[model samples]
Target: MREGSPGWARLALLALLGSILVPLVAAGLRSVLWALVGIAGLALAAVGVWWTLAHTGVVRAFGVALTVTAPVAVLALYATFGMLWPALLSLALWVLALTAARTASTRGRTASGQAVAEAPHAPWVLMNPRSGGGKVGRFHLVEKARAAGCRVVLLDGSQDVTELARRAVAEGADLLAVAGGDGTQALVAEVAAHHDLPFVVIPVGTRNHFALDLGLDRDDPTAALQALSDAVELRVDLGYAADRVFVNNASFGAYASVVADPAYRDAKAQTVLKALPGLLTDEDAPRLRLRAARTSAEGLQALLVSNNPYGRAVDAGHPGRRERLDSGQLGVVCVRVDNAAQAARLVRGPRSPGLIRLSAEEVVVEADTATLPVGIDGEHAALPTPVVCRSAPAALRVRVPRRRPGTRRRPGTSRASGAAADWPRVTRLALGPLLRQRHQARAGASGSDSGSGSGSGSGSER
Candidate 1:
């Protein structure tokens, strides 16, 4: 609109460039990603060819490199080398950046290349007073968040979070952020969905499981804060049990019992440690019959489910071991072990083995014998058995760093680095129990009306 002013021209150039280039960029980058991925496949294929040629002994040990003619010895023949294709996506991005930059707009001006500051509206910051050795006290994360356009609020032991969040949403807030445990994370998510605002998850609690999944840095609140300004809003699917929302998953049976134990609050570490000896030593733990809605099922000693089927287990199943957050499915994992002896034998150390695993849209679980306590997304709850599990189908919107396609590394090389997604700005309203009931009533009334021959209000009498 302006005559060659760098600001307006650049804006116009970017708008035009984005419109013309995004698809082309998407297509081109996709090709590069697939190309690098394909190269990786070729490399693996070449290895597989070599592995096939080598029947055994020393020949089996060495393999030929696909990209290079140089022969590799058995030292290089790792099964994991093939999986590097996906990981190599990071390399493909730099190539893409160069290519995209080469195709210039007629305006010929490059992006300002400066990462913009992320200032979220209505940020709800909740901290856990009891988490990870009280690390929040050591770090002034709240003050830092306040400095970065965040409306900071503290969580006093999960007291009235839904209420506090509901109030924030009512006051025209656009983001709900939590710096606490998974329990607090899910609670904040509930209010975020209630108001339909973007929820920022700052992992201050123990493990920071979901944080790792989103490629966020738990140790650095600034990186998490940068996520507010740096990444796009992904409408991630949330798992629901009863009235609560779960970014992780829900399980009934073994872990449920452990979580439900009142002493678990105090003896979580000790109890787990004590239980580990028996679980590893003995091969017997309580065997529970498992059933899902209208599906053939098996018996499990301890059943655990994640929002997404977790990635290959590492770090005793905590920390680095995180599930795919955007799979649009819930992961169901079932295990069988009875008695302390059997549990010891069946349980695989701290990180449990994934068994009877599958991604299902919905699951209805019930047991034949005793009622089961349930653990939903690392939070405890009680159900009378026959618990229902289903995907919420894009219910929660979260802010996560925009990663370059085909790689796990954060986008830093291109102008698009730290570019958050432009989310659809929507109004947030915490649907009160009364309002929720009214909404249900309206639906019922509408259903009844639809069942009958209904006309316009006044004219219906005729």
Candidate 2:
């Protein structure tokens, strides 16, 4: 169906409404008895884990028994409710809801304020052959970059990245690029910013969070190479912990401790599981002490300081994504739970009361130890106590491809037929028909002003 047609609009409205209600309806249709049983089962499991951790003799024995029984209770509830179809249907409905919400949200969004410039005549790209399971070799990024008129530098074990980037700029390379993780990106971006050159990102690394926020195609490293020819540069903020630059975030406390482990890369999940419980429960005073204008806390389990704030709520639409990278404030989340009970409650619910969230231009942290381990954009390092962190506003000029995935509509454009492009917007769109109906009713009743009312109402309705 044609997008502007009445039939198409009506269909879109219905689809949007269905997407909004189906998940709620499916959840409501679930058996309340079985639901309560499921909750009990979860609570029991959590209690068991907590007790085991506490290690009181009788409590530990009971905890083991409860842990063993919790799974049986869950399986029994599944069988009682005939959960197979309902489980599958619930998953499908949730997925549909997310899709609709994403579609609706992106419609109202616009592209970042980016300057149009000529692509550099002489571009230099630094690549890590070992990043992302050797994505450089698998994707043939070096060959692709060279073909795109880039001078490629393979990052072997010998050379320092910052010095290499500095050398490239000094050698008259007009543009600098990195095909690795955020750590390498930060190194090269720092040099590029110092030299006032635009930087390009080729996301050939594990969890390219910075590239994802840039709206680049993380799945295709080759598509990122297109930036060498397309000169769309966005001015974004950069975060600094002392002299070190981090593109995404720098983490302190428990997570830092975990990442600092020499064997963490070999067994990430296991290492975290083993390290986290002790990190949270140990009575020794927390090494990291945090202080900001709006907050003061000690013994924080972890603190995350990001270049830009992530969305506060964990809903399907945004899913911890930062809406804008240009915000001149750092996003901070601090977690401090004194006991296992608090941690269990946190895991069982949406958010813990213990979470301290804030945005600030600067934050100061003092560690009890002489040196503190910090995780900077996934790379680990040890920095001295009393670390000072700050946000540098509009510090970097990052060049992206002209035609890239997840590109938003520009502001001040006509939104007459703007349908939702992101899932959260779908929820808003689902409410539109009812709002329009109310407005029409009001317009009809107020006969003298009906013309203006109806005309104004119709514009948003469309």
lDDT of 2 by residue, 78-111 (tens): 7665664554454465555444443344322222
Give lDDT for model 1: 0.55
Candidate models: Cα lDDT each: 0.55, 0.73
Candidate 1 residue 426 C-alpha distance from true site, Å = 43
Q: Return the lDDT, model 1, position 214.
A: 61
Candidate 1 segments whose C-alpha is farther than 4 A from its true place = 1-119, 269-287, 292-295, 313-323, 338-354, 369-371, 402-462
Q: lDDT of candidate 2? A: 0.73
